[model samples]
Structure formats: structure tokens, C-alpha cells
Target: MILHGYWRSGASYRVRIGLGLKGLAYQTAALDLRKGEQKAPAFLAINPQGMTPALQQGETVLTQSPAILEWLEETHPEPPLLPKDAQDRAQVRAMAALIGCDIHPLNNLRVLTALRQEFGADQATVDAWAGRWITPGFDALEVLVARHGAGWSFGDRPGLADCYLIPQLYSARRFNLALTPWPRLLAVEAAAQAHPAFQAAHPDRQPDADG
Candidate 1:
């Protein structure tokens, strides 16, 4: 398998964690987002959406992190990325969605770029825009984590929510948001820091990160 992604992309980071947790050995194909490599003709041929985190396996190419993660869970069921109970699975999916759906879309690179190009948003304004969405989403996640988290986001094991939450927390820090308000989420982050899968998947550890 080949994973095509940018080093700092949160969506790509989520997919990396999923691949690691599944113990999948895949080659990295780094797309330089800063250079608009994702929008280039070659990448658009792989994914017309012109997005990162597109997974290629033989003849099949997969786009979208959520779908990729779901495929990983479905194909590699050992060390399951979800709880056995249906209700527990739903709860974990909800945690993943809160970040993937509610928070990430607003603060994603495209939106931030649009804010700058279309609305004259400076760095300070961009930071403020990120914080506006991040703070509230984190507030809700803090409560949800307190209720459901054991050691990881939804349980004692690192699962679906951890894959989503860790990347979002990384993005939160990148945006210069103080994480003091979410101790539960912080504890999960601490748990992730010690976990090998997450350690391997960190954005800074990526092959292209230095460039």
C-alpha cells in the first residue's frame, strides 16, 4: 500500500495513526502541500478532490480519512479500533465525528487559505479564527472524554477516537491554543504519547516534515 499525504495535514495524521494501529506496513508518498503539490495534475488524477491521505492498494485507490479508517477497521479486525458493544462503538464514532466533522472542517488548510485570500485575514486573525472553533469543540470533548475515556479517548485501549483526537490536539497546539481546559483529553494525549502507534504516526516524525 502507498499512503499519499502531507506531513502536517491533520487528516493525513489521522490516517497514519489508523494504519499504525492496524500494524500495516505501507510506503509514504509525501505531497508537499506548501507547494500546492496536492492540486497538481498527477495528484488530481489519483483523487479529483485534490486532497491528501489518499491510500493506494494495487488497483484500488481510497480517498477520505474516515472511509480509510473504516476500511482499516473492517479489514484488520485484530486489536480492534472499536469496542465490542454496539453502543460503545457508536460513542467512539461520535467522538471521532466531533473532531472530524465539527472542528476540523472549519480550521482546515483550505478554509484558512480562503480566509486569507478572500477576506484579508492576517496571521492573528487566522489564529483567532482557529481558536473560535477549537475552544468550543474542545470544551465539549473535555466533557465527553471525562464521561467515556478510561486511558484512551473512549476506553482503556487506543481506538478510533484516539486516532481522531490526537491529531486534533496536535492541530490545537499548532494553532497556539492553551489545552489547560481539557485535562481528560490531555490524559488521553499523554496515553497516546507513550503508545508506539501514535508515536510512529506523529506529524513531526514524518519523512517529509523537515522540508
Candidate 2:
């Protein structure tokens, strides 16, 4: 398998973590978002949406991190990302969705680029715009994690929620969002930081990382 993604992309980070947790070996094909490589004809053909985190297998190319992660979970099965219990699975999915659907989208590269190019947002203004969405979403996540958390987001094991949460936290820090208000989420972050899967998936560790 080959993962086509940019180094700092939060959605791409999710897939990296999932692949690591599942012990799946995959090569990476970097699409430099900074240079607009994702929109190039070759990549646009792979994913018409021109997004990062497209997973390519023998003949199948999957776009969208959420769908790719779900596919990983379904196809791999062992070291499952979801809890076996149905209710617990839903709760984990809810936490993942909170970040994936609500928080992450607002801070996507496309959205931020549009804000800067079209809406006259300066870097400082863009950072504030990012924090506006991240802070409240983290507020809700802090409560949910504290309520359901053992050490990780959903339980003691790092599951689906951690896969999503870690990347969002990374983005939050990127935008300079103050994380002091969310102690519970920080605890989850701490747990994930020590896990091998998360360690391997860190943006700084990627082949094409700017740092």
C-alpha cells in the first residue's frame, strides 16, 4: 500500500496512526501541499477532491481519511480500533467525529488558504480563526474524554478516538491554541505520545516533514 499525503496534514496523520496500530506496512508518496502538488493532474486523477491521505492498494485508491480508517478497521480486524461492545463503539465514533467533522474541517489547508487569500485574514487572524473552532471543540472533547477515558480517549487502550484526537491536538498546537483549559485531553495526548503507533506517525517523523 502507498499513502499519498503531506507531512503536516492532520487527516493524513490519522491514517498514519491507524496503519501503525494495525501493523500495516505501507510506503508513502508525499504530495507537497505547500507547492500545490495535490492539485496537479496526476494526483487529481487519484482523488478528484484534491485532498491528502489517499490510500492506494493494488488497484483500489481510497480517499478521505475517515473512510480509509474505517476500511482499515474492517479489513484488518485484529488489534481493533473500536471496542467490541456496540455502545462503546458508538461513543468512540462520536469522539472521532467531533474532531474529524467539526474541528478539523474548519482548520483544513483549503479553508485556511481561502480565508487568507479571499477573506483578508492575516497570519495572526488566521491563527485566531483556527483557535475559535478548536477551543470549543476541545471543551466538548475534554468532557467526553474525562467521562469515558481510562487513560486514552475512550479507554485505557488507544483506539479510534486517539487516532483522530492526536492529530487535532497537533494542529491545535500548530495554530498556537492554548491547551491549558483541556487537562483531560492533554492526558489523552500524553498517553498517545508514549504509544509506538503514535510515535511512528508523528509529523516530525515523516519523510517529507519541513522540520
RMSD of each: 0.9, 0.9
List pairs with backbone clashes in candidate 2: none
lDDT score at residue 35, model 1, on the 0-100 scale: 88
Worst 10 residues of 1 by lDDT: 147-156
Model 1 residue 41 distance off true place after TM-score fit, in angstroms: 1.4
lDDT of 1 by residue, 24-132 (tens): 9999999988889999998899999999889999878999999999999999998899999999999999989999999999998889999999999998899899999
Q: Runs in model 2 with CA error above 4 Å?
A: none
| Highest lDDT scorer | 2
Candidate 1 clash pair list: none
Q: State the TM-score for model 2.
A: 0.98
Give model 1's clash tally. 0
